[model samples]
Target: MRNVSIDELDDTPRVVVAIGTDYAHGHLLARHTHRRAQLLYGATGVMQVSTHDGSWVVPPQRAVWIPAGVAHEVLMLGVSTRSLYIEPEAVDLGRQCQVIDVSPLMRHLLMEAVEAPLNYDEAGRDAVLMDLLLHELARSTHLPLHIPLPVEPRLLGLCQAFVQQPNAHQSPRQWADQLHISLRTFNRLFRQQTGLSFSQWRQQACVVLALARLATGTPVTRIALDCGYESPAAFSTMFRRILGQAPSVWLAATNS
Candidate 1:
């Protein structure tokens, strides 16, 4: 795992740190929780952060707001990553966990925040800068891509299997075979329980897997192949269709 220690940060009521990397292995950070609420931004790369309730894939143009005290893991896909972590008490508007769009003002302010020198002054221009940063966060948009996972042991077991092997491409029939259920019954139950068809659920699983790999800087071609795509071009096309941009362009426009 590629790691960066964030200890010894300045003594502001909230902490802000900037992280940028270009490592490729499909895993960037581990599962951990912090006392502070965290805002995870990926200026580049697609990132996946999962909590017990759901998994979130944060695009380069967006950030994830993790409420203080929630335990979650971070997964990085291919492309470079420039992230900013903010303390929860730093901002009052975004107190809950969510994924929100990072505006240009917010992005610029974050860059400035990270570049600002640490100090202990009680009042000054620095204090004003901090307040502006908090305001920018409130103006950001919230995007919907949280993948809520089922809590049942049986369902979770299946989810774990798929996460371990994203390219499995198993059909409901195959899933039924493994679970010792009739294909028709499995299909009915899966939709009834998850509000998604077997294929839809699998696509969501695949996308999250793709997000994790992309955040780690895995090659688009290799990720596509690993995720069972026939070719990188095909994968990019699909990614653009779904994400509104080609992978490389998305990466470039999001962060730096």
Candidate 2:
């Protein structure tokens, strides 16, 4: 792992800047670290950030945290990312970084930071605004949008297939047979690896897909069917139970 140290600038705040155009390729091409903590969010595309313990896929609505000195990398699926780079000493965030939800205000502050002049003058108003921005950012709630990946080859393959084709109407028994395992054995494996039962995992996966589709203006009936729900009512019941809001409400909240 390579570490990039940023020296204090005489005019601008002593923030070392390391910009990654496509963080996925940057991480793939080189596995490195830096003194600055990173708040990685996509301006348009999505990316996945993986640490030793877990991995998180960051869609446009989420951001992943990379603590200073943590040797982690990203897998970007697209381009034009607006990653925010912050110095550890300058910001008062707790040690050990993790993926955090980015609020609209935080997003605006970050874009403001990018546009702010990089002068070394400590007396500039940008410093005050940046500090306030960081404080506000620390209060944001993180959503579990990042799906964790399992190491077991059988489990991993099964999960990948499920995520790629979430609407597949395969029964647990069928999946167990396909995996050359008994129903009981396969159920145990799912609990062991994902800490969720087969049905629970499938439901969550289906809801994840449904949420994304709904955000894109997909009809509830269509999304419910596409996500393997018997009907929109069943999907709505499940959705309301898990999210505490209906599909329309959730979509409206996000869009608003």
Candidate 3:
């Protein structure tokens, strides 16, 4: 159903409910939770999803899977979303949130599903389509768009600050000194808490942050400088290394 709130139909007998909603640029959906797992697809624009654990940048044509009951917030940028809310028992997409690619077939299926009735006939063509949608979701490839947050209070504070003003040249030694810990200890603790080495996590954070600006037609050179890269070429190199496409190429795909 287009533009309908899921809360109003949360008790529908169907295992899955699909809805589409459009948002103005830079709209923020404050922290909330759902009883059903959600496949939140961005048919256009970008989405920034955050939870206690970390944040994810969902690029255009991609989606983020939010497990049931995970309190999260979304910052939508010129987004038109197609969301599937599925009963927890009906799917096993793991307990963690993930960003996943939307195949062409799955994209068309999502468009179709959102147009189906809230209580689509279980024995009809819509039922078959919903089944196919679930299958597509189960087999979808997860993307490396998540930036996990560290839990240690001191370290978490530093990490949070870095995310606000990401600098590629920021070193672990600097963070360690601020925390009054040895570099070795900081590195070990960072990896243990976030499952990513300091450098890897920093790069991921820069890319994800850059994506939000990139969506709004920000130039690569401007984003590079803002992200603390010395040159757009250097920034594009790292962006390609992490996302497998140069910033311009990715932007073209997003705009297309």
RMSD, each candidate, Å?
5.0, 5.7, 0.9
Q: Which consecutive 10 residues in model 2 have the weakest lDDT in total? A: 1-10
Q: What is the lDDT of residue 165 in candidate 2?
A: 76
How well is each residue in 48-77 modelled by candidate 1, as lDDT tens digits?
A: 788787678887667888877787887776
lDDT of each residue in 128-190, candidate 2, tens digit only:
666766686678676644455567887788778877777637789987998898999988987
Give the 10-residue window scoring lowest on summed lDDT in candidate 3: 247-256
lDDT of 1 at 27: 72
For each candidate in the order shown, give its overall lDDT on alpha carbons.
0.67, 0.64, 0.94
Provide the clash count, candidate 1.
14
lDDT for position 81 in model 1 = 52
**Decreasing TM-score order of the candidates:** 3, 2, 1
What TM-score should be assigned to candidate 3? 0.98
Candidate 2's C-alpha runs over 4 A off are 1-36, 42-62, 66-81, 88-99, 168-171, 182-184
* lDDT of model number 2: 0.64
Q: Local error of candidate 2 at 27, Å?
A: 16
Most accurate candidate by lDDT = 3
> Looking at candidate 2, what is the lDDT of residue 160?
80
